[model samples]
Target: MASVIIIGGGIIGLSSALYLSEAGHQVTILEKGDLSDNCSFGNAGMIVPSHFIPLAAPGMVQQGIKWMFDSKSPFFVRPSLNPDLFSWGIKFLKKANAAHVEESAVPLRDISLLSKKLYEELHQRGEFDFGLVEKGILMFYKTQKAAEEEAHLAEKGKSLGLDMEVLSRDACKSLQPELELDVLGAVHYRCDAHVYPNQLIKGLVSLLEKNCVRIARNHEVSRIETSAGKIASVAAAGERFSADHYIIAGGSWSPAVARLAGLRIPLLPGKGYSFMAKEPEGRMKIPALLAEARVAITPMNGSIRYGGTMEIDRINTRVNLNRVRGIVEAIPKYFPDLHPEMPAEKDIWFGFRPSSPDGLPYIGRSKKLSNLVIATGHGMMGLSLGPATGKLVSQIVSEQQPEIPLSAFSPDRY
Candidate 1:
């Protein structure tokens, strides 16, 4: 069995450690920050097979340009002089076409389905309940243009064998009769599921410790030692750690981490925000996505969370009040009766998504360094695809064939 060292203690790293340990490998996770607070802890907790199209789809460039002028817009690309951002922008524009979207759909769907199945299996084992429910997601649209777009995407999803149903306003209201929805129509993707991320993170950590996985918290990886085209060790927190193999899953910081190893991963940090409303007065049977606003609402365990806004900017946790207000205002626009009080700026949770230009995650071994594996750049689908990514990483570590094709998500695709 190979001794493995994984960078980052978020969902991707922990999930990878879980599968690696289960495969008889000795695993150690090196986290740069506190384990209790990270990217995977306070996310929307959505497991979506419905999102087959990548972020770099057609018309996104134009939309992003328009959203740039609005501070509260759902998607905003902050102007910057950083060379990495410039390079990423160029690559993003190149891939913003129908061909890239079509190429990404199958692999994205396959991995999501694999992860959904894995989540079910894990939930059935009675490890701990993190509110893993397959109630499906409701994508509600208020305008005719938005409805038509969703219908087209639903048709594409249906053709790909996903269970998608486009519902009229009355039909949507019939399914969600408890609350007053102010949308023209909805697309219910039955292939999706939801989870409470906070619970999942705590549960996974406990399970990993019980299984003898060493978790070094608050230990940041600084230097990567490479010799003879293979990773020798990783130095973090003034300590050198040696392992037979290394996996970098550091989310938004992945690119910088790779640079230490003489590699470049074209990734940009897309910041997003979320806030929870405890014991909401409105009733919600399932999670819902407000299409026009790009906000996601999930009724987790006991509280309700509203999350949205993807800001492509530098790595920081600064809370933009305008963006927070946008989420607050967007909530009532869809759920007419569910106008919960807006969360304070301090109460909001924000994190950076490791977004790749083409919206495909890097999930394979390094071509130059045979022992180093790259598994970051998941963008908005990290939670939805974590387990499958972990499982695939293990398969790669064991020299077994990956269950799904890796061409689309290759690290060298650029």
Candidate 2:
């Protein structure tokens, strides 16, 4: 069995460790932070199969441009002098076509569905107690135009065999009797699910530890030594770790690690904000996306999590109160009685999503580095796609055929 080293201790790295160890390989995971925190913690806790569409779709360029300057906007692209950002933006604009989106939709949907199933399998093994609820997701919208547009997307989802239903304002109210939804309509996807990220991490960590998977936390990988297009060793934390294979999943900071092996990955950090609250008096069973406001609310564990905002600028971990306010203001609009009274900073949380312009994650070995695998740039779908990604990585490391096509998500596709 090959000895593998996984860099990045987030969900992707931990999940890869789980899959590799289960496959009989000796695995070591290197995390730069305390293995307990990251963007994965404060996510909407969604296993989102309904997110079949890539971010760089038709009309997105226009929308992004319009919202670029607004600090409180759900999406913001801070213009930078960085050449990589420019190239990625240009390529993103080119790929923003209906055809590309349609072509990509199937793969995105399939991987997410596979992940949700894998999550179910893990849950059934009855190893840990993470809140895994397959209560479906509702995309609630305020305007007729918004609802109609989303309904069209929901129809597409239904065609893909996902259980999707377009509900009117009244029908939405029926599904969510607790929340007084102020919306025109909703698109509900029953195939989706939710999970508390910390719980999953805890369970997975225990499982990995039980199986003897080595996890090195609070350390950074400084360099990768290569010979004849193959990785020789990864120098990190005053030691040299040589492995038969390596999976780079450092999340938003992935580019730093990839560069050590001479790979030029155009990965950017898209910062997001989130906070937790007691479940409003009339808590709903299903996790729902507030479409018009672009916020996501999930009944995680027992409490609710309010997460949204895609700020594409400012690399540091600074939490912006204005952006946090935007998400807070949105909560009351949907659940009228819900109040987020805590100081934005106290309840504030920010994490960067390693974003690639085309909305597809880079998930294959680079031609330049024979033994190194690139697995970052997942953007917002990291949690939803973690299992499938780990499975694919295991297959690739075993010299087995990939479970899905890799061309669509190649690191050099750009």
Candidate 3:
């Protein structure tokens, strides 16, 4: 049995550890910070099969250029002189086309479906309760143009065997009678679902610990030692960690971690913010995405979460008040009845999503390193794709065929 060392204690690492241990491998997870919080936490918690389209799609460049002027825009790219940022931007611009979208749609759908199924399987096992709700998601659009676009996508989803429907204003209101929605229509994606990310992590951590997986919290990976084109060991928390196989699932910090192994994985940290508030007097039953505002609203077990903003910037934890204000302003526009008080700046939770230029995850063994597997660049779908990614890594380590095609998500693609 191979001894596996996984970097990052976030959802991806934890999920990989679960599957690896189940496969009869000794797994060790090294996390830089406390396992309680990461990008996995403070997310919208939506398991999105509805999100088949990649971020780098046609007309995105034009939209991004327009949004650059608005500080409160949901998608903002901070201009920088950083060489990595410039390089990544160039790559992103090149791939922001119809071909990339068409190429990415199937793979993204496959992974989301696999992860959604895995979540159901985990729920049936009754090992842990993480508030796994399969109520699906509503993509509400305010304008007729947006509604038509979504309807087109819904047709595409239907062709792909996804259960989708274009819901009129009345139908949407019927599904979510609690909220007063002022929208033209909505696209209901029945394949999508929601979960409580915090609870999911806690349950997974508990399960990993119970299964004898060594989890080293606060152990920051600093250096990777390599010999003969293979990893020898990794230095973290002032000590060296060696294992039979190594997996890098460090989320936004993946590129930096890969540099230690003399490899370059182009990844940008796209910061997203979310905050939970007490459920409104009449909370919406289903999770909904305010398409025009680019905000995600999910009603969890106890509280409701409002999450949005894809600020592509350097890695930092500073909270942008304008972005938070934008989210607060968006709520009343979408749900007229819900008037939530603006949360304090300190209460706002922000995390970086490892965004690839092409908007597909990096999941495969490195071409240069035989014993190392690189898995990151999941972007906004990290929570949705975590379990499927973990299962794929396990299959790779075991020399078994992956459940889906990995050509689109190859770490060495770029």
Candidate 4:
């Protein structure tokens, strides 16, 4: 069996390690930060097959431009002088179309369904307890126009055999009995599941260790040693280690790391912000997506998290107060009974979602490298797609046939 080396020990890297080890390969995961944190730690833990729509859907370009100027808008693109950022923006705007959306929907839904099954199997095996809930995701809107647009999406879901339910304001209140809901109508997908991010990350870390997978934390890969068009070793933190195969699951940093091995994958970091209301006053029993605001509020095992805002800029760890304020502002529109002090606290947390211009993740072998696989650019759905992506990568490394078509998520598609 080939010895596999994976970079970036977030959900993608850890999941790959788990799958690779299960396939009888010796696996080592290299993480640049603490195992307990990163994108994996601060995400909306929803396994949503209903989310077939990619971020680059049509009209998003114009909306992004408008929101970039409006401080309170949900999505914002911070202006920058970086050429890569400009290139990514251009490609994103160009690819936003019905055909592209259609091309993306199937693979996305299929992988998400596959991943949910895997997660359920893992739970049955009793690997971890990360508060996985399956009551479904509620998409609520305040206007008839919003509800009509969402009903079209619900129709599409129904055609795909997804368990979808449409609800009126009274019906929505029945679903979420405690708090006052300001919605006019709702589209609920019963196939979705939610989890606590921190719990999942920590539990997986323990599970990987139990499986004899080596974890190299706090060491960033500085250089990659390649010979004869294959990986020889990876240089990180003044040290080099050899492995038979290498997987680049480095989230927002995948592009730069791939550059070391002479591969160009256009990946930009879409900065996202979230905050948990410590003792949240209002009630949010089922996870709901505020349609007009494009924000998600999920009730974890303990805390309720309100998260949204996609800022497509270079990977800068800067927290935009205005964007954070936008999430805070957008929340109360649907849950008008929520406490007003939600956004007042400056204890803000932010992480980058590795976003591709086309909105679909890049998964599969790199065309230029025989032993290197690319699995980044998951964007908002990385957590949802982690297990399936890992299983696919492991299959590729082990010379097994892919379970699903890779055409929708080809790394070299661009």
RMSD of 1: 0.9
Question: Against the unseen true structure, what C-alpha lDDT does each candidate score?
Answer: 0.92, 0.85, 0.92, 0.86
Point out the higher-scoring one by TM-score: 2 or 3.
3
Clashing pairs in 2: none
TM-scores, each model vs. reference:
0.99, 0.97, 0.99, 0.97
TM-score of 2: 0.97
Q: How many backbone clashes does every candidate have?
A: 0, 0, 0, 0
Window of ten residues with lowest summed lDDT in model 3: 276-285
Give stretches of model 2 more than 4 Å off: 280-282
**Candidate 3 vs. true structure, TM-score:** 0.99
User: Which lDDT tens digits does candidate 1 get at residues 1-414?
Assistant: 999999989899999999999999999999998887888877999999999999999999999898888888999888879999899999999999999899889999999999999999999999888889898999999999999999999999999999999999899888878889888999999999999999999999999999999999989988888999999988999899999989999999999899999999999999999999875554788899999899999998678988999999889868898988888998888888888687877888998999999999999999989999999999999988999999999999999999999888898787
Preferred candidate (lDDT higher): 2 or 3: 3
lDDT of 3 by residue, 1-414 (tens): 999999988899998999999999999999999887888889899999889999999989999999899878899999889999999998999999998888888999999999999999999999999989898999999998898899999999998889999999999988867678888989999999999998999999999999999999899888899999899999999889999999999999888889988999999999999998898464678998988999999998767899999999999868988988899899889788777678998889999999999999999999999999989999999999999999999999989999999999999998
Model 1 spans with C-alpha error above 4 angstroms = 280-282
lDDT of 2: 0.85
What lDDT does model 3 reach? 0.92
In model 4, residue pairs whose N, Cα or C atoms come closer than 3 Å (at least 3 residues apart or on different chains), thus clashing, are none
